[model samples]
Target: MLLREIQDEILRLKQEKDIAILAHSYQSHEITEVADFVGDSYALAKKAMTLTQKTVILCGVRFMAETVKILSPEKTVYLANSSAGCPMAEQFNKTDIENLRAKHPDYTVVAYINTTAELKTVCDVCVTSSCAEQVIRSMPQDKIIFVPDINLGTYCKNLVPEKDFILLDGGCPIHASMTENDVFKVKKQYPSAVFLAHPECKAEVTKQADYTGSTTGIMEYAIKSDKKEFIIGTENSIVEHLKYKCPDKKFFPLSNNFICGDMAITSVFDILDCINGKGEEIKIDEDTRIAAKKCIDKMIEYGG
Candidate 1:
């Protein structure tokens, strides 16, 4: 079937079957085109929970799909592409966190949302890229151990100077690879454009940005502001999303090399196949689900 035909079928099936399709900002242009909602991971998951749909198709990475399952366990959640897994999310498992907890008994383990459901089970609280600093700072504890993203942990440390934090050697390789030089080059080319970056990026890149936020936050900021041009510092797919959402504005990529293969792997065909029940459905054990839900729920309560 052609791309348009598949998209038409998705629209028809969603209405006929009470389904909702959620795409991440990093999804392909075609996938985002047909999605009911497209935003950051936490926002998508939270939106999925409030949705009245019977089934949800998450067109993102494994952990994002798992987050939908975590929030709306009653609603059937399907991953558009099972192989689309985040390397940062897979960095720390339950065993690793359990060992870390044992080693640092005095510290509270805070996990980034880009983590497996099992890892969340071992975490004291969960945080997204947007709320990590706020949530971590609000905690009463003096010592904290942040996992699965060293860049983000370092960013948090910079924000809360008084607190002691142990940063794990894990991060999004794609974002970490970006440097201040990329921001400078983009600024030189697009002097009029505002630079917006993701906090997962290295401190140097983030420090140079005109504004730093999560994928969804960046979209909202660009859309709401009168700025006609912006240099987006996340995945390349975001430029596609912004172009669609705000046609009047010009969105430039920070660097041609800044891309998340994992997030970009899922295509519109994968989403259509998932909605048609040919793709894989994410399933987690009840124990893992319940335990993970605790951490996620705490995030909703405190982090929100």
Candidate 2:
């Protein structure tokens, strides 16, 4: 079947089934075209909560679908690709965090939204890449525990040195693979381009970046900037999406190794299969759901 034909079927089925499709910004442009909403994981999950659809299809990672399920417990959430999971999210379980909490009883447990719902149940607050700095700063606690992604934790830690942030050695392998050398190589190639990076990258990579932000933040920065060229430091899909969005502006990826295999695994067929009820439906226990929501509620209270 043709791409258009498949997308048309998906479009029809979603409406008929009262399903809302949420795609992450890291998704392929083709998937984004068919999605009802596209943004970062936390943004898309928040968007899912506002949807009237009885069902939601998260065309991203498992953690993202879990987040949607937590926010809108009344609605059923399905992961388009069942195997799509974040390594970082799976790195630390509840027990590992609990052990750390035991050590630092005075510290606030701040879990990145990339974590599983189970992890959030034990967390004091949830933060997204887009609002990590602001949310972390808003906390009344002097000491904090930033889990799952040490790279992002380091970025936020450096921004607010006054706060004591306990870091873990887990992060997105794709983003973490990039280094200062890669940034220098890309900058040398695109001499006139501005360097934009994600905080998930290492300190060396972020240190050389002209701007560092979330997926949506990077897109908005590039769009608003008068510069005709940019080196994107996030997922490789952003370069393709940006090229299509702004033909006049040239977009170069920081490294060819920036590809995220997990995010790239979902196909249009996966969306079709999901809408057809063949996908993985994310389920959480009532106890887990209620407990998990506390951190998210705190995030909203803190203006996340």
Candidate 3:
């Protein structure tokens, strides 16, 4: 009946049932502890596709579970918490992308991986925060329509100043809300600590960072870097994970307000309930799966 006992049971059940648990970096530490793999959204989905598990419990949001289903249509994908949804993912829809495409016939649409499957259906290619810069720079098109996250699009554009990017008016409200003052305060508090930021943050916030990257990239940098302290400019959950990963190093969050309530809503209990057959399972239509796969496959082919 205890939490430890439940976790043990969940792990045992996962092995007995051939289920792979995939946790996003923004998930709680307890959830990550029980997961088979924990990383960024796209990386977690890609890893799920390669696993031989018949079922995958995605401890993230609705769109993330849908992404796993899109990648591995044969496997059963379940979202740990059905209520957990990304606001940014919900900001754009199929009609929105179609409308944009109609207006700009000559531009190639590059969607951020944090999107609904329906949105992916209309995209020319998909990109993750970590690979967006590289993928966009490698594309043949001179004019790019980066969607659903203007902050990330701007970050990519800054990396490739020669290319013209049409950024959509959508972004993570949590990260977008972060101001230059937050960056200044963090810097002042930890003068020696290196500042690592996520591309989802505003341009001004990212400009003050020592390094800008995805959530996974931030974690990797902190682990590999020689620095003893770091100021993380992303979701607060990441700071929690970093503390456990590197107990010797000091990690400070850019702002306490930079929290994704949706991402944080899912916990180990929800994941266990799903594995026990009491949670909602993510089901995608064959057409949507096929359509969504096109953009994701293109992303893997080009971004890989």
- What TM-scores do the predictions have? 0.96, 0.98, 0.97
Candidate 1, residues 3-87, lDDT tens digits: the string is: 8998898889888888899998888888877899988898899899899997899999999999999888898999999899999
Model 3 clash tally, residue pairs = 0
Q: Candidate 3: minimum summed lDDT over ten consecutive residues — where?
A: 295-304
After superposing candidate 1 on the true structure, give the runs of residues whose Cα lies further than 4 Å from its correct spot: none
What TM-score does candidate 3 get on C-alpha atoms? 0.97
Which pairs of residues collide in candidate 2? Answer: none
Tens digit per residue, CA lDDT, model 2, 1-304: 9999999999999999888999999899889999999998888878987888889999999999999998888998999999999998999999998999999899898999999989988899999988889988888888999988999999999999999989999998999899888988889988999999999999999999899999999999999999999999999999998999899999999987789999999999999998888999999998998998999889888878
Rank all candidate structures by their lDDT, best first, as comma-separated numbers.
2, 3, 1
Tell me the lDDT of candidate 3. Answer: 0.90
What's the CA error at residue 104 for candidate 1, in Å? Answer: 1.2
- Candidate 2's error at 31, in angstroms? 0.8
What TM-score does candidate 2 get on C-alpha atoms? 0.98
Index of the highest-TM-score prediction: 2
lDDT of each: 0.88, 0.92, 0.90
